[model samples]
Target chain A: MDIAISLPIKDETLLPKLTIGDKIRVNGELFLFRDQVHKKIAENDTDQLDSINFLGSGVYYCAPTPVKEGFLIGSFGPTSSYRMDKYTEYVLKLGFKVMIGKGYRSDDIALLCKKYNAIYVITYGGCGALLNQYVKEVKLLAYQNLGTEAMQRVLVKDFPGYVAIDTFGNKLWK
Target chain B: MRQISCELFSNTLKSLLFETQYFIPEDVLENIKECYINESDSISRDVLNNILQNAKLSAATKLPLCQDTGIPQIFLELGSYVYLNFNLEKTVKNVVNIVYNEEKLRSSCVSDPLIRKNNLHCYSLHVDIVDNESLKVSVLIRGGGSENMSKTEMLLPGTTADEIKNFIVDNVINMLPYTCAPVIVGVGIGGTFEQSSLLAKKALLRNIGQRNQEKFYSMLEDMIKQNVNLKGCGALGLGGRVSVLDVFIETKPTHIATLPVSIVLQCHSVRKASKVI
Candidate 1:
């Protein structure tokens, strides 16, 4: 059976429907961050991230171009996720259920996703401009020193992606 | 001798850098169009559509084609007859700064690769001098996806062609969907260790679908493509015939006792542009 869903998903909603090989298209704001922003978040204890409700939320491993005069952001796309694997368990604990990025993940992270009933999606690696159009709105959140790797809240519409690893421990590609 | 102002050189560099961020080079665009029209799988087709649309939108809206706008790499062939009134290195730096600062392209360069600290706002530039009166520059916006997949090896003189092919094929299969497909493979052979790797990168700068001039190198290109495609890492590695868009090889003379090779993968978004002044 085929199922379609929207973004800002709840853990229960994702845990049941998505399986290996199932495609997912999310319509919600995607946050962009790379190594620097992730490192900062990993080192911090204040829980500043609590303000953002991640329950069933998706985070794209990306460092976007700075916003120009009229646009919300520039050339937004996914970066490799392996670099951020260390923080996955913690973020999942915070209620962020889905992660979007390119490349493979550690086995521990995959197991964690299965335990937490979360999913990891992979988008095309170099399709930044193509992916940016889906971003409806973008707000700069934090990590100013990081330049392109700064954290920003982004709203996306019909953001197309494929499930690389799903909640049930099925991997789409070996 | 003709005199060119520093400002002119700087501005020209700026334009090339900024324009290259969004615009797909003519050859790359054409090759992708061919792929889009010929691809059989619906999913792959849709992906191609997204890529094509992204290119159009990026060009029209002046947004970078990808977030990893890549380290700013410049290849220049400066003419001997032209006199530069300003420092070439400073001019290049100034242009890179303007593009990254004002244009808002991602700063891919970091202070330390191991430490992973972003070096404020900086980009990478490679300069070369050639015999010419007019400056010819090629600006390549290389994504990290492909850059990370690059590999280098030093083999004993007895390394067989079959072994070389297997090594490359093994790397490609292992990468699977990670490096993104269909990838453009660039192989550099016969140079010293570092030289081979640089030649591999330089090979990637060639226009997509352009064949190598040497007959043997051309055959090697064909051999690599067939071997890689047989692995079934298809388009996006989802399983299809178009695993690789093309394979390019560049070679140089090497030591009698050593054979070196470097494999550099270029993702589907093969971005590069050139300007002559």
Candidate 2:
């Protein structure tokens, strides 16, 4: 079944709604971070990273090109999730309800998603041009020197993704 | 002997970078379309369609095909008789800096591995001299994903064909969706450690559908392709029959005691372009 989800991922209410192989389109708030941001956050406290107080939010692993004159964001796509596997457990424990990226997740991440009642999504890799269509607004958040790897808060509408790992421990890929 | 100024050469490099990043080359597009048509799995089919759509949108919008415009690699096959007016390497870097700024591409290169400072003046260059008088310049925009998945192995002189096949298949399984399969696999065999790896990277610069000139290596390329696709890693590694579009092998004579092998992966968004000066 296909489901449309809004930002600020609420309580465990939406946990049972998605299953492995389910199609989903997300709308609302998403935080963009890549390897550097994840590493920095892992070394620091969650409070230092917790400027935005949202219940359950999605975090996208992306490093986007610079936005041209009039565009909201440049071509953006999910990077491989496994590279950030080391810091995922630390970040997920902090109330982030969902993770968005391409490729397979580490076993530990899948297990954590099940335990924390969170989800992992897979967007098509290298489809940055098509993916940018969903992004409505982008605002810089932190780490300006990191360039594309800097954290940004984005507002997206109908961002297409597939549920790779659900809260029930079911996974789309082995 | 023909003479070309550095300014004209840099201008060519600038446009090639812009063209390749935003538009999928004709040969690569045809191969992907063929794979999409032959693929039976719905998931892979949908992903393939999306890939093609992304290419079209990028061209129409005049935006980069992928956000990771990556580190630009410029390969120059210069003629021994040709004359150059300026420093080739410096000219390349200057052109890249200007083009990067004008195009608004991402600066993904890190200056030092440990400190991780972004290097805005990064370019991977290889220059070779051919016997002819004209110069040929080729640019490859390599993304970080497939480049990270690339591997190199040095084996004993007595290693068998079966061993080579198994090693490659194993690596493919390990990379899975991360390498962004339906990739072009380039294999370099028989050179020294560093040369073998360079050969593997250079092999990816070949035109799609181009085959190894030697029959023995060409057959090995065919064998590797069959085995890789048999794994069914498919497009995005979700699942499909066509895991690899092509496999290229470049070989050089090596010492009798060592057999070096290297694999370089190029994802489906293969961006390669060339110009003759």
Candidate 3:
């Protein structure tokens, strides 16, 4: 079904409503993290990560261009999700129900999502300028030293995406 | 000898970087539109439409086309008779730092791969000295997604074009969705291991929708392009008829025992800008 749904961070009810191929409009807060942030969160002390209170939230695999003046944020979009597959179980276990990224997810990650009652969504790859319209605000949360790969908390309105993997293991790319 | 000031050069680089990141070249844009018209699959067509809209929005807003602003790559065709007032390498890096910060482009470079320390000021510059008196610089914003999918292979001297075709097909399939199709497949054949890869990247700098000057290589490009699209990798690799927008091949004579081939895949954005000064 071609339906648009709103998904807020720290919400669990939206996952069940999403199925493969359904267009989603994520309206709420999203935590932005990429390669370095993921590795840090998975390997380092969890204190910094725990402080964010991202449990039951959506984690967006992305990095933004520098935030320009008078704008909430810079052009922002999803990075490839497969690179984050190794760390999926860790974040999913942390109660992240919504994983937004781009490209296909590995079978293991899909299985993990099924086990954890989480879902994987895809934003159009390389559509950063268009996606930036949804960003309402941006805040640097932690790891400022990572520069671009640092963790960021962003508030988004009507953020467009598509469900690539459902909790039931149905994958749109497959 | 012609003298160029560092300030002029830096300003030019900055402009090129900003313009390329925000705007898709006209030829490339036109080719994508053509792909959109010819695409039959609904999903692929929708994906192409999104790409088109993304280009429009990027140009309209003066924002980056993708969040992966990419590592800035500058290819300099420096003339032997031309002289720069300052150290070229350091000058380019310094200019990149100012431009990236001033333009709010993302920093994707790291101080060390293992430690993963970010270097916001880093840029890669490749310098080639030519006989002419003009300096030409070509800039490409290579996203991590497609850049990571580049492949190089060394085959026996007798490796056939069919084998090369299979190799290209296999890599595209393996990199599906991840590499971001309708990709431009740049293939380099018959140089030393490293040169082959360099040629592959150089091939990407060529104008889109244009074939190699040599008829033999052009035919090979067409053959590979046809075979790849037949794989149904489609737009964004979501599945469709057009997996590739174009295929480019660059070649050089190699030693008798080596048939080195390198492939560099460029996503649909294909952000490139060049200037001859």
Candidate 4:
């Protein structure tokens, strides 16, 4: 059978139809962050959050290296999603439909994904150099105090990621 | 006697930092290329291609190969014959600051683990002095993905070599895809707990694809590589032929009652550089 699907599937009705081997290519603006940025967000530091409007988009747990000249970012790869489990529900509440990272998530976040129509995606963990090319432009968001963990607004095109956790609570790994 | 100025240390360190960021070490690059050629899965092969292209662009453009330019770690072998010149810590800090600001590398380091504020951007540096006139420094730009997967355990004295191998193989299997498979495994055995962990990290500083000098250790490395690849972790843990590029083990004699082992994984982007001055 042949089929085509449009991504950023905000509607929950479409989640259950996804299968294990299904490949998804998401097109949306992304927000980049890591441990420090997540901590700041949990602490209610909205100063950096103001720079980005992630109301209905995705957030990538990443700490990218910088480029030499005429480049926006460097070796931007996914960090472990398990570390962000504590903040997943909160970010989902703030209106992010997609969470992209690597590794598995906690049960709490899995449950929240079911409650709220959101999907968690996983990318190759160490493929940073390849992943950076997907980022079209990067705008600093907040948490300059957090260095690489600071939040930034990033534009992506056909960003490749797999649905690790779906809205219906289906885990690709488990 | 050679009198080394603080300025000299800072300059050399900065150059090493920049060079490591720009050029992927020849051996590591070669291993990844080999994986690309041997990879059976189409998707994995394509992913490896993308990774190779990224390395090319990073090197030619003089950009950091991967973001997480890692903590500013320096393994220094200071020469005893050299006369004092300047403070080592300050020189390292200066080089770190220059790299952080000038190169725009992400400031991944923080002041405290608990408070977790990005007050400092330099990662921790480990220094050691040896009896020599020329200082040898090895810089490793470790990425978070593989570092996070490190594990340690204190085994009973009765634990056999088979047990050690099983422990390592199990951990590698469990961390597949998560730690970015096709990893380089470094094992530190027989030292104290902390010493074992440090030895494991130091093992990562070895040239990629090189074997340990001890015949038994070298044979162990070969066994580990074969077993891990058989796990089907493949490229990026998607399932393929080459799950691990290399495995290196370093061991030292410990108390008869203790057998400590530490495992540190290095992803395909094994970025490291060394210089003796």
Candidate of highest TM-score: 2
List DockQ for all candidates: 0.64, 0.77, 0.71, 0.49
Candidate 3 has which clashing residue pairs, if any?
Answer: none
Please tell me which model should have the higher TM-score, number 1 or number 3.
Answer: 3
lDDT of 3 by residue, B1-277 (tens): 9998888888889889888889998888999999999989877888789889999999988789998888888999999999998988888888888878888888787777787677755677888899999999899889889889898989998878788888877877777678667888889998899999889988998887689999988998998888878878777667798878888999999999899999999988889999998
**Pairs in steric clash, model 4:** A48-A142, A64-B67, A65-B67, B79-B132, B80-B132, B182-B243
Q: Chain A TM-scores, one per candidate?
A: 0.88, 0.94, 0.92, 0.86
TM-score on B-chain, cand. 3:
0.96
Q: Candidate 1 residues B210-275, lDDT tens each?
A: 889988778778888888877666667666667787888899999999999898888877777677
What TM-score does each model's chain B reach against the true chain B?
0.90, 0.96, 0.96, 0.95
Cα-based RMSD of candidate 1: 2.5
The digit string of per-residue lDDT tens for model 2 on B1-277 reads 6788977898899899889889888988999999989889877898898999999999988678888888888889999999998898788888899988898998888889899987565888988899998889898888889788888889998999889878876776677678666789888888899889889888988878899998877888888888888888788888888878998989899999999989888888888899998
Question: For model 2, how does the per-residue alpha-carbon lDDT over A8-43 read when each residue is reduced to its tens digit?
Answer: 777578866898777798999999998988888788
Q: Which CAPRI tier for candidate 2?
A: medium
Every model's TM-score: 0.91, 0.97, 0.94, 0.88
For model 3 chain A, the run of ten residues with the poorest summed lDDT: A1-10
Q: In model 1, which residue pairs have backbone atoms overlapping below 3 Å?
A: A29-A154, A29-A155, B79-B132, B79-B133
